[model samples]
Target: MNYGMVFLSIISNRFFDLLDVLNKLNELKLFTLFINIKEILLDLRIPKSKQMRTLEQWFEEYAVSHQNPKNKAIHYVCVPAIFFSIVGLLMSIPSGFIANTLKLNAPIIENWAVVVLLFVLVFYIRLSVAMAIKIAIFSAICLVANYYIGQVFPLWIFSIGVFVIAWIGQFYGHNIEGKKPSFLKDLQFLMIGPAWVVENLFSKK
Candidate 1:
């Protein structure tokens, strides 16, 4: 007769024990979730400050000396004009074999600018993919502009004049800056200059 009461008591005790275990498990799960979230936030905060800066950093570094208002003003025109002139100079080379191979109706389509600028684009891409894309687009426009300019006048002669004059202006700006141009030390600065200009312009706005 007493067996039934004892059996009920045993069942009640086991139920309470199970409830206690479940509560502890729930508390443990909440604590673990909190720890994971805290760790994730810490990871996000830490790596960014420690990681190396991107190509943009290099641009800003080069820009230090160029901060002189006179120098900054000169670069706004000279950098792009120099780039365009280089494209024009390359285009001035006689089409030769390239003219016949593609047989495109537009002479400019298969001209030296496209061939030469491809390598330049790869150079830019190696530095920074996003900047490279922007430069590639701008270079394509310059090539098309060169094609038209070539139609009206002596292209190579004009480009050389532009290149020399622009460079003179650049050096004059640097003199005012009282710091040497970055390109003076490393030729890579030549490629980086245009991107630096583009990034600076956007950052200014």
Candidate 2:
């Protein structure tokens, strides 16, 4: 597999797990759901197009082909629902820790920083709903995992360990496909890794 596939697989696994959790929480209020969807979608880094209508039309077509007719809207809504829930839970942990350590009035304010960052990402990029959902899920898992890993191992050591493991999986996937890894040509392929898996899942459906 190539590095891209490896990165994508890890992200896919985490997102699938999160989807399981979101399925159980599908009863949230409409306004809350809309806000969460907006917040989570805001984290995509897609480049803008001069004609957004064309892009929207393309996405609509893609959605119809990839998503079940009965569940198309649900998929978009649920994907982000799962993503933001995981992020909210994971970020709260460190935010509480930081608040206690620094004696802050509102430790939860740290989450606002994350919110601001997501706003910047969405404003700059134009990712599909599925892509945004997958990225959000995987990014949250990586952040939480990295935090705990850093406590056990030095940051550099932990990073190197993850890099080695990730690369090995990636090369294995590439060996099966017999194609050059996407990352070798464009760094943005790094972001596409997770989205690719999500697309595959949708295609299967």
Candidate 3:
């Protein structure tokens, strides 16, 4: 008898719940961090290209060269290791010039790895907001781990070792798959590789 009123009440409650979440993000000063490329495109009045692809499209293309079970298993380990090693190498670079030029002094923000991660985050944000958030969390962990590991060993040397070893593992995996790595065809696939791994891992759960 009062179906219309019940529907309105449910909608009202959901609207307020969303507002509460937004407020929490604001309180944490992370509201801006969650922005995506669609918002940026809209702000600049730019239209998406007809040829532009979605995240899943990139994943599909990447999967074409990674079909073997052995290759997939190797990627499960090496892709992340390569990413972490790259970040570690960047972290090892001196950031005094960058910090001085920007007049910024915070240890975290002054890091070369942290600076590069911002651009990396933007790349993921263009693909998907959820993916970007996942990557951002993982990037933070890499920074923390590199900081501690550096105190015990030379960061650049350690990063170089990991990088070389991980690539060796990757080449071995591709030999099993009998196909060239996708990144050889398109350099952007290097970025797609990590996102593809993260997307598959999360989808399994």
> Model 3 lDDT vs. the true structure?
0.88
Q: Evaluate model 3: give its TM-score.
A: 0.72
What TM-score would each prediction reach against the true structure?
A: 0.70, 0.39, 0.72
Task: Encode model 3's per-residue lDDT on 1-205: one tens digit a residue.
Answer: 7999999999999999999998998998785655765578667652355137789898998999999999999998999999999999998899888888887566555789988999999988988998999998889889889988998999999999999999999999999999999989877799898898898788665
Error of 3 at 70 (Å): 0.9
The collision pairs in model 2 are 1-170, 1-171, 1-172, 1-173, 1-174, 2-170, 2-174, 45-125, 46-125, 46-126
CA lDDT, every model vs. true structure: 0.85, 0.51, 0.88
Report the number of the highest-TM-score candidate: 3
Q: What is the lDDT of residue 148 in candidate 1?
A: 92
TM-score (C-alpha) between model 2 and the true structure? 0.39
Of 2 and 3, the candidate ranking higher by lDDT: 3
Candidate 2 — worst ten consecutive residues by lDDT sum? 65-74
